[model samples]
Target: MLAARASDDGALADAATGQSEGGVRWAAFRQGLVTNVLNPKSIVFLVALLPQFLTDRSTWADKSVLGAVTVLMVFVWFCAVSLAVGAFQRVFRRPGARRALNIATGLVLIALALVIVLTG
Candidate 1:
């Protein structure tokens, strides 16, 4: 919802300014948050992974604290990634730069996926 609104608002603003494409400054950050929160598989993985370090006698407060810390870590990491990507946007703005970036990123993703598939 926030992403759609941001995109629409950005598009309108850009159009008024004669800019063809809209900037995703805030939209990308919101997208990272939404993707992290909406992923059920990630939640399940977190639940399964976190409990391995917890004993049966561990209190709810302990789990809550651990979860909060984990979430904080995720927030920090996402912010760092978003900032880095945003900083690189200027370099990718040239003609054919975005296409090259897309191809490179796609290849990296495919390679990572293949590694995961083969390892898992």
Candidate 2:
């Protein structure tokens, strides 16, 4: 998830720096979503992680409810991130700004990965 977020951020940063048009922005967003949704590992992760939280009472109806909640959460998170990144588009348009943002995001992702690894 963090990696996906970083990629989204990187794309946004690139757009900001390059003055990308609406079509470009839409393409980037679609690419990011596809990259994330099509990842096989993500399916494996959902299979592994969600089942751990499943209960004996988790019938098909319950599963559907949980699935809906999960989808809603993802929607909210992406919307928030998109809005936040859009707000910074002008700031990231300056030369070197996008590079710095990428570096910072990369560092954050690395740090998060390390923490997950060490904790797990």
lDDT of 1 by residue, 1-120 (tens): 111222232223444655445354455456767997999999999978998878999999998899999989988887798789779756655535655556678788889889999999
Question: For model 2, what is the C-alpha lDDT against the true structure?
Answer: 0.75
What's the lDDT for all of these models? 0.70, 0.75
In model 1, pairs of residues that clash are none
Q: What TM-score would each prediction reach against the true structure? A: 0.64, 0.62
The candidate 2 region of ten consecutive residues with least summed lDDT is: 1-10
**Where does candidate 1 stray beyond 4 Å?**
1-29, 109-120
Give one digit per residue, the lDDT tens place, for model 2 in 54-83.
Answer: 899789988888778887888799889989
Clashes of each: 0, 0
Q: Which candidate has the highest lDDT of all?
A: 2
lDDT of 1 at 39: 96
